[model samples]
Target: MSSHVAPDDQATSGLDRRGELREFLRSRRARLRPEDVGLPSYGRRRVPGLRREELAQLAGVSYAYYARLEQGYGETMSAEVLDAVARALRLSEEEREHLVRLAQPERQGTPQAAPPPQRLRPSVQHLLDGLGVPAYVVSRRLDILGWNRLAATVFGDWAQLTPEERNTARLIFLSPEARDRFADPERTALTAAGALRMNAGKSPEDSYLSSLIEELSQKSEEFRRLWARHEVSCGTVGDIVRMRHPLVGEFDLVHESMALRGGAPMRLVTYHAEPGSRSEEALRMLASWELEPRR
Candidate 1:
């Protein structure tokens, strides 16, 4: 069936939830194999992941019904049907919620507008300044709003780069040096892309976000490929992150993200190293490398 934009999506949701749902479902489906769901391996399949017929069988629904829903044009989907699909897909809480929103955005409530990324309260800046390790604040669009000296030393000096270059998503996908900074580039990009997807759902009309995505899609082939997968994630375990900083050759760091009080949408992220470890020593070295910003 053709993936036509639903009238409801056109009239109400402006974030392309139909396309999101279609790819999300297909991506999840593609990750599974016949043996994964206890199904016997059958004839050779042209495409990867479980076939539509196989999934339908597992979800206790007809192939036609499953196909239509997968295409993101379901009509009055029952709660039971959704629950069954969730179970079949083995989706986590966030993934299930995302699915529900895409399947029936009409049921979802209107979300609040995200504040300006450049606007940070003085108190929040103080909190960043007080942090011993690398710390920075980010918007839903992943803009680097506020950051301390440590962040500059470790994550690179955003002052030198343009405002758009400071975005985590942009840095991860568009810049090769930034991608090399992370130990697991693929995982980093995938999770960041997922977070961007989640953020787009909430703020569908953000022009900056739209432009950033378009630029990445056009510039980087890998970003375009990963974006097509529709894999989504809120965050990843920061402990797995190993940064190859210029001052410190290789140091493992754990990231901590907190929602500052009165800052509903803005978040502060701090990096920490294990106590008395080599990484910790490297962090100290990084701190020493921090220089005063030019007047």
Candidate 2:
């Protein structure tokens, strides 16, 4: 099979890390009000959220310094300064980490090289085959690497999708079937966007990753809006995903993701229905059904 990387598009090859950091900081600041950070609301403002000078005051930095930082001159910023800005913005733990990543990509580590085609180990595939619940493994890019029989039954057959189409972000944002299957497609979109944003911060130089984000941003307006929010998910585990399976009707399943040890940054994601609930019965029915062989 061919690599999943999109065809070479010079426009989307490299991420503008400084641009990302500036926008992220701006987004975080835009969410807050003068009152939110204990500053008194003053005269009518043209824009939403606290003013730049106000944020500078809150972060205990000069307005000129903060303005430069917001304009993507953060390469020389100290950790203490970044931390202060994070606290001032009232960023969540994941958001804080994301801020550090964007502001100090060099400090974080070397930009990762483009990874080779990902494959699941035989033992990992065996583990999936043995599982009773719907389960799949996904790469750091949210690419579907492997899945079990029940997962295919519950989530639609991944075997039907092209390698590029197997990505979770692509499924959520680009697939018409996903809009119908997900109980809250909007929430799912937000989660997917957040995860992608976090990954982009970590590997700003990854061409495939940059291309995926560009495609999603251009194709999905909802994804574009969510991406602008600058939300980040340190891990993929998210709220209970309520799915409306075509065969089994509607059911809620708790989602969990864990990184596979001693390997690439692949995560094993599993969905389990609450015990003794109608959802469990639905899942059981899916497991019992004889799924058609993969093409």
Candidate 3:
């Protein structure tokens, strides 16, 4: 028997989500100080961050062309240019992959019927349970799929919120409480924006993502300014996060992510510390607190 495929399959399967790439590049460029990259500060500039002309010069592109690219022009951007831009922005390897994915999303063999629900597999869930560490799975869209009890405790009230409200990016920019929760609110806010920039490139047509950007832009002037800068960062693995929990007080945690197979909507995230460290002691206290029954 012969099988027939839908005519629109190719378009759907091979869709390119370059809008995110533009956003990511812009965001990264916005955060850098002129002196950070060995350029002398000429004089008092109106913008606190790097100017577009300075970024273009560093990335070896014309200011007008760079503006067009960040504005989602989707012109033919060469790999060489992409490389230069990544270098100028000091993008990590993972961040570079995120850039490539946004610039050229891989055409899947089959089109997905719907966006994958954020979920963790049984095996991964079991692994999380066994590790007894603060762990969770986050989707490419920054959805918190599944998290351990310790994760719930460590993240405080934020973790207890409904999945719709638990989004890190939304909470960081849209919720004032989140800003208070983090010790370094400004860094947290910028990092969340950068991650969102990376995601924008991969799923440009996603309404939820667009809605998030709109909400943040309206609610937070700082978010609006950072969003316009269009920086991107792949926060997938090995990032240090310092948080001030209402219960645990304050602790430093290492955030690590491992990819799952079979297009799983989840990536494994675990928080741990060096052996016999103060963080380990904090983890023990956290675990004890989690075991106690809630009032």
Candidate 4:
């Protein structure tokens, strides 16, 4: 579980963090079956795992009240109620802390002021160069901070855009050109939007994030629908991206993201083809094209 803060009611404010927390907790609980958490699999259960009534019983709350809480209609729950819910769900220490953080926003101070603008370190740049693949570093806000030659070749149009326009989520949702570039545009868009949703919960006050969400909501109906789904995914490792590059046609590549140790606002992303596949040939071609000196 990631950290989350309470949301302010102001329009200028970002996501309602408490709302996010309630939704997250509810979603997590809804997925568990009784057998999943060592509960007895007694008679024909109307629903899998613990029903709302059973959960309410365990937490010492009325079913109506627990339903209200899950619906985000009940605020001001006592710490005792939260603890009971935590125990019922078998929450770990970290998850319990996260729940408390969400329930009691006043306890945590305002998020730290946005960090200063920083560039990738020379050593990190060199490390990317050595990888000799389509690689780049991005901020939590999906800003492209730096990239090697192969990345420039693969995401050239995106890389050439201004800082305000370089966001991956924005490209997936707002740009028709970007939408057409992916083999399965809908899946690609949903995945990108879901990743952004995850980031929103992690850093609710990010100005860039707020701007990106506003832009997408206004510009793309598809994005708006997907955003409302509240899906969250961290594309940290082993995620596959299917691309229909104008130059390379079609190829499937595995993507991985690694946080740079002690480096603020930078995560390295790299892509590679599965072994003994046509994607390998496509990657080699991409590299050759990248290696050529430009005018």
Models ranked on TM-score:
2, 1, 4, 3
**Candidate-wise lDDT, in order:** 0.75, 0.80, 0.65, 0.68
Given candidate 4, what's the lDDT at residue 178? Answer: 68
Candidate maximizing lDDT: 2
Better of 3 and 4 by lDDT: 4
Worst 10 residues of 1 by lDDT: 1-10
Q: What is the lDDT of residue 89 in candidate 4?
A: 71
> Which portions of model 3 miss their true places by more than 4 Å?
1-77, 84-91, 94-119, 157-160, 176-179, 291-295
Tell me the lDDT of model 2 at 139. Answer: 81
Model 2: CA > 4 A from native: 1-11, 234-238, 293-295
lDDT of 1 by residue, 145-185 (tens): 88898887887767788776788988988878777777788
Candidate 1: residue 274 Cα off by (Å)? 1.1
**In candidate 4, what are the lDDT values of residues 182-211, reduced to their tens digit?**
778887787777666666655677765766
Q: What local lDDT score does residue 175 receive in model 2, on the 0 to 100 scale?
A: 89
RMSD of each: 4.4, 4.0, 8.4, 5.6
TM-score of 2: 0.91
**What C-alpha lDDT, on a 0 to 100 scale, does residue 127 get in candidate 1?**
84
lDDT of 1: 0.75
